[model samples]
Target: MLSIKNLTKIYGGKNKAVDDISLDIEQGEFIAFIGTSGSGKTTALRMINRMIEPTSGSIEIDGKDVMQMNPVELRRSIGYVIQQIGLLPHLTIKENIVLVPKLLKWSEERKDKKARELINLVDLPESYLDRYPNELSGGQQQRIGVIRALAAEQDIILMDEPFGALDPITRDTLQDLVKVLQKKLGKTFIFVTHDMDEAIKLADRIAILSNGQLIQFDTPDEILRNPANQFVRDFIGENRLIQDRPNMRTVEDAMIKPISVTADKSLSEVISIMRERRVDTIFVTRNDGTLLGYLDIEDINEGYRKGKDLVDIMHRDLFKIQIHDKLQDSVRTILKRNLRNIPVVDENNILLGLITRSNLVDIVYDSIWGETPAGVDEA
Candidate 1:
């Protein structure tokens, strides 16, 4: 557990990055710090680890004041990760990943075992152990950085926009990875980011900061449904407009009607349909009403270059929530599948309607801010 009492960080005469903030972070809690630029979220985090010495107040980690501990020892016990990743170029992937453990004087056998475990934990191949940092992609390097922080087996991890540099797909993957890792390790996490979506998706509890002050701290649903003020509302963005939408509504409520696409369709064919219809995804079905897979532009391009079949490229491991399934169930499918759109299918695999991520968010917003549209009511 960690506790902050009257935490304040001031720069010279006028810059106060954190202003008299107090918070208690329980063990195994995934807490996110969110705010716009100059909000002092990062400052508050840094002060906890003595990365940035606080101007006043005190921070206690597991009951002892962090300021009273040696900075080097304190840092070793707390994992730190930043947006830049900061992997050592001279080191091999395994070496880079094992840096912290090595610093802690872990045995060679222990180090090797830990390295392999972390590599697999982050979904990297064991073959990457011998590879240099430069030989890996940005996402791979970021994974290595995460493994390195985790190498020492620290109880608390301080991450500042750890996934900010990766692409959207990689970002989502890593977010899922972090969620899994947190459950496995049961360690406390203090994460800072400007991205509200990421905060909401990953956080067990979110702490909103504005102009160096703590504005609100609560669960994602609470924050989304009942924003503390206009500042928090605007900060959450237009997505908040639909926080109250019915979760009971099905894809039938928002899906585009008329089944589309063929099993033998080529990437080019799917692309043409997407462009012509101004749609990003289409459902694939067989002649006898069997649902095959869903095709999106990205799926087409990835499969096209390999000369793969549409069915082969299609994600067959599709998760479907019925028309009457709870809205939370649909949202879960979207998050778990990392999908932007999901097909609402009946028991017979009948293609009903589609529910895009935007539509789901809109439903939530409409439930809160406006009347449910006539179409949804009918569906």
Candidate 2:
């Protein structure tokens, strides 16, 4: 948890990069700071890890003042990702990933294990671990950048326009990856971005700033429904303002309970359950119902001889929808990706339900034949 109180940063004694901004960020929340260029979103983020010393006010993490902590130790204890990525080209992927841990004197075995674990979290192959950063594509390198931040197992992550340089498709993929990672890891994320769509899609709360001032801080849904002022409303864009439509539904309204198995289930046990359920793919979950990954009949058949558990052969690369997301978003993704079913999860990656093709079909039919509801207007 982070508490920013009267946080202000001034440049050359007059220019306020961040002016009297204050925020209370909860654990595991994805918070995005957004504004036009020179609005101080990045300055506000850097102050948290003491990358930029605050000119005034204070920052506290779980009641401990960040100013009182050693800068190097504080930074190492918190994850930081940036657009440039800054991965050392000379180091191998594994080495780059565990660089912080190594600097902190982590054991070789621990570093190696952490590297492998993080690579998997981003759905990258372990074989890539031996390759250098140059060998990877831009998107691959960015994925590494993201997981490397997690290698230290820090509870808080600060990202400054991390996906800004990538192509739109790759950026979208990485956005989904980061959102899922944040939920699965239960880490607090403070992200700086100028894109409103990105903020609304990935953040639990969006903090809008202007001329270094904190304009508004609220959940995306709340902001969409009720922006604080004309500046807040205009900044978010008129097109994003939601219409009061009672017919509108969220993914939670349509999702059915998912067919899932605990990760601890053996391959044989999963196969039997799948056979009985007549489902090709089943969500693999941890004991707490965290959606760990997914297993299909093909995976079971191939890995059966290896005698591994469902978790061992499960696919971590899969699309999922948040329960509170608009049903239209799910429909768009399912149709675009040609998916059979997508898991629905809460903010914490807890398995809530699943939206199947049948569910989407029904929603589509209703949308096509039912009365049209009002929508956001073009600016």
Model number with the top lDDT: 2
TM-score, one value per model: 0.75, 0.72
lDDT of 1 at 129: 100
Per residue, candidate 1 scores C-alpha lDDT tens digits across 8-124 of 988997788899899999999999999998999989988877989999999998899998999988999888888999999998999998888888898999999999999999888
Q: Candidate 2 — what's its lDDT?
A: 0.88
| Model 1 worst lDDT run, 10 consecutive residues | 239-248
Q: Write the per-residue lDDT of candidate 2 for residues 1-379, one digit (tens) a residue.
A: 6999999999999999999998999999999999999999999999999989999999999999999999999999999999999999999999999989998999999998898888998998999999999999999999999988989889999999999999877888899899989999899999999988788779999999999999989988788778899988888775444321212578888889889999888788888899899999899998999998998788889899887766678899888888888875566557756889799999999999999999777666554544545442211
lDDT of 1 at 121: 93
